[model samples]
Target chain A: MTNKECQWGGEERGILIVLSGPSGVGKGTVCSALRSMSKDLVYSVSATTRLPREGEIDGVNYFFKTREQFLSMIDNEELLEWAEYVGNYYGTPKAFVEQTLASGKDIILEIEVQGALKVKEKFPEGVFIFLLPPSIDELQNRITNRGTESEETIRKRMTAAVEEISLSEHYDYIIVNDKVEAACNRIRSIMVAEHCKKERYLPKIKKWIEEVL
Target chain B: MTNKECQWGGEERGILIVLSGPSGVGKGTVCSALRSMSKDLVYSVSATTRLPREGEIDGVNYFFKTREQFLSMIDNEELLEWAEYVGNYYGTPKAFVEQTLASGKDIILEIEVQGALKVKEKFPEGVFIFLLPPSIDELQNRITNRGTESEETIRKRMTAAVEEISLSEHYDYIIVNDKVEAACNRIRSIMVAEHCKKERYLPKIKKWIEEVL
Candidate 1:
């Protein structure tokens, strides 16, 4: 048996899981529960050109950097996926994710549709899971209950959601967040199953077979 | 929400899970546990031309078949995969497995490596999971403990195991049968995760999107 605490067949590399869905789908709640559920699971902390807000630690909250450094990373192809959001470059740092996975920890990336698709281009084997609200009515209700958005803003979000769902087919799996705990469990199950995937154990298994023979 | 008793993303067609490994790798134990673990799971009863031994139930033990009927099934391509074993044709019934799946029940097929691979060629979408022992030595120990096997038979199986492990990379997932219960849980998790696969929901999701839009 390999040193992995998870009892998979071979020495398994940590899986990269990209989770994407529309707003008001309760992704945050389910991801938080997942973090508590598995100690081996890590949330990918993105690097940003924007300054960290109050009480935000450098690496823990976000890897805050100047515009020059952030742009430098993009030029070096160090970011898995990056985009300008409100004039600040926010992106998943490739090094951070690689280092975390190298340490035998599975990383879950909660990102938007574009970013998730971009990550797929970079890491084609990554598991892409799309989270969906139970129903459109429930999704609208959840958005409205937020009370922070104007009706116009809510309508804009709903429109965006429809477009987001249209792309859900590109994902490897779709998780309906009808219940928070159930959704978290489903993600965890996906993680475990991914570990058993043939791609992860190919090299090690080939070597093991030769040695055993 | 779909009629699936299991809460997956969409109405899932029952998946045909083909489980195969070396003879003494404890697939029987894991699969038996799985049958009890999920009531929705059904074991695929193979059709064999060999006469049913004393006290053997026709449909329950094996679909006891005459050589003529089995030959006709082969001609009609009714058997998904078949093999001539000791002058008797043993095979999986395509109709039975399809009907079981169409009725929204997962069917587990415990077959040899050749049969499993054959089934994969026929049903490319079926989940092919390779059950493996922790190591070659442990596998020998297991076969030895079986007392029913002669030393030569055990040695033959051990040699066969090396080839099987080499081919395990062809499987969708590999389950290490370290602990029976743990292996069972891994299979169950794989089943749940497979249900959430996007390919299973593509057509339904498109229709759902059109309706919602």
Candidate 2:
């Protein structure tokens, strides 16, 4: 890092901010708000064997891949985390994340709790934030307000949310998704603060001191 | 600790932000800017055996104390860290800091690197930030700008700064003081992010889930 870049935001590796939460929490809304707030953050594109829906652009929306290509990627260990859902394979390509970080561009990964935990195992340094509904009642209201679901499905989802929230202890940070803007701001602050972490800049500072001072 | 307090600003114990750096690193300037930016942070007043200077208020500026009082406090372990300088004693009172934090009010302690390290030993959870000049040359310029010092004193201070900076590895974060506003922003973000730390809120979250969910 140059002396001018020493101010901040000059890290050689970008931070991976993983957003996860229970089903009813506003992780998607918060992530979208965060994306609008900062152009510096890049949203990680997922690679999937599922066919791209109409109006979806490859590489922009998802890295559309054939079943054989996805299987080859899995064999080569090119994916960070992969899941088989509804007979389709979906995964995050390790190459894009690693390249973005190497180029000093931060990437945001919004995934389920299990997927976020899987990412954590691969990249322990990633900042994992668990988005939470304001209250259990609030989560119930949100789940019910999505009127498309049956009562049985809502109950099942609520149980799943509680189970997912239990695993929140493994996350690095917890953000209550009471307000979308507030949650996004918390995420923004976390990103800024993570850059200031001692481990990220200490070696560079040490080298700078040795060479210049 | 409640559902209403589950958001980012609801930490039970206020954070202790300890700002420390080498001499001429603009720690004071950055701290002052931070104070102006947020009224939520309280400045920790030092207890001193030295007589209060003109216009200095008791308790507000410094907690004035007699030599006996200071010595007794030291013996009683009432002080977080103490130093005897120029025939007088000065120290941070552990009570005031603890009381402030327990009241859910964050306190800022701007001290020398040695004093900061001492506080860290006593309260390792404190957020230790090492402020740095943009570059070694900039640090030299800042030191030289203090026109009252002799050339010999300047050289001594430069040596001291280098030695002090070497201890920055012990700090939790590093902020380059290129601009006071920017440095203050980093500290603010750090304060915000620290509140979101999972360890601070996970227990409450778990209890909330158990009792309410």
Candidate 3:
């Protein structure tokens, strides 16, 4: 409990850590590893118009929605960020993330680069982390190893990956996915370090210094 | 090692981490613990006109200097930050810190707040961390526990500590010294997280994307 006070000041809302990168850069794997490593982090499940895959439960894997419902959420500004890809709509529902953070629990959002950028527009305070492959060859190898894409689709993905990487300067931190465990550790470090930032805890610190002396 | 590129980009200078806070905030203890845990961080030895204490070695504990020698170093601007304390001149020698960082090894400098502010003027890129006691009463307790200071000296230290803590808003991060091991771990997290900062590696990442990809 002593360390808890030191971990973060009392009564502050938790941080939103946005994990994004080019497709196939292992964002999901790293985020899952990070969450497994630390119980303090809550994953922000997204909503999608796309049909659920086998065994994917609604609200657990994603908030499966109809296209009309997803569009309505977007129109009402109830979604933090949304994008259409390959003929299906995907978005982050704002209410759950807001409620979780207000309760002082940190949340991790693993999303596409475009969705991450949109979230940054609305929540500038969010910690935007850009994941990266060890190299282009490695990224290509990852996509190839998945064995789901055609040669033409692979080329398109590589080109899109390059474009996404170019926008990395817009992120707060970069984690190259050289190894899953190492990338996860770096993310944990980033989370701890963000908690220590003066901007987040200075008011509480100042109050403690001024009042309780 | 693959992780080396991920640790830091090629050929960039290492960071300088400045650890400073109030007089009795346990900055030194936490820093020493940090060094013991991390082999990569080199501790910076300061220069002083004050005579060396028992078992203190020249260039190890401090670069012991006469008033004349200290004044000359000040005249030549060889010291990064110098202050007169208890009628003695104390300073951080500029050369060693610069050389260590330039050679791509981080250096930790634990010093008074005044001296740290001076170092900030010279090395703006350095990571400035302010250590804090859990509370003012805790800080007073730490000073009292030292047993070397008289009542009047303790009062003076408490006043100075307050003034120093008020300036903490200028720091990049803050670590409350509730527990020494926890504080050390937080400092280590700051170091690791600083490497992940986009500002530190954006150019390298951009170049990699453009050229190597």
Winner by TM-score: 2
Ranking by DockQ: 2, 3, 1
DockQ top scorer: 2
Off by over 4 Å in 3: A1-3, A6-11, A52-54, A148-153, A209-213, B1-3, B6-11, B51-55, B148-155
Q: Which candidate model has the greater DockQ, 1 or 3?
A: 3
lDDT of each: 0.83, 0.87, 0.85
Shift of residue B167 alpha carbon in model 1, Å:
2.2
Q: What tens-digit string does per-residue lDDT give for candidate 2 at B99-203? A: 999999899999999999999999999999999888778988999998888999988999899889889899998888878888898888888899888898777
TM-score of each: 0.92, 0.95, 0.91
Residue B171 of model 3: what lDDT?
A: 89
lDDT of 1 by residue, B68-133 (tens): 999999999999999997898899999999998888778999987878999998999899999888
Residue-wise C-alpha lDDT for candidate 3, range A20-122, written one tens digit per residue: 9999899988988888988888999899999999999998899999988998999999999888889998889999899999988899999889889999998
Off by over 4 Å in 2: A1-4, A7-10, B1-4, B7-10, B148-150
Against the native complex, each candidate's DockQ, computed on alpha carbons, is 0.50, 0.56, 0.54
> Tens digits of per-residue lDDT for model 2 on A1-213?
111376333477888999999987888888888999888899999999999899999999999999999999999999889999999999999999999999888999999999999999889989999998887789989989988889899899888988999999999988888789888988888888898888877776677668746
Candidate 3 TM-score, C-alpha based: 0.91
True contacts kept of 3: 0.58
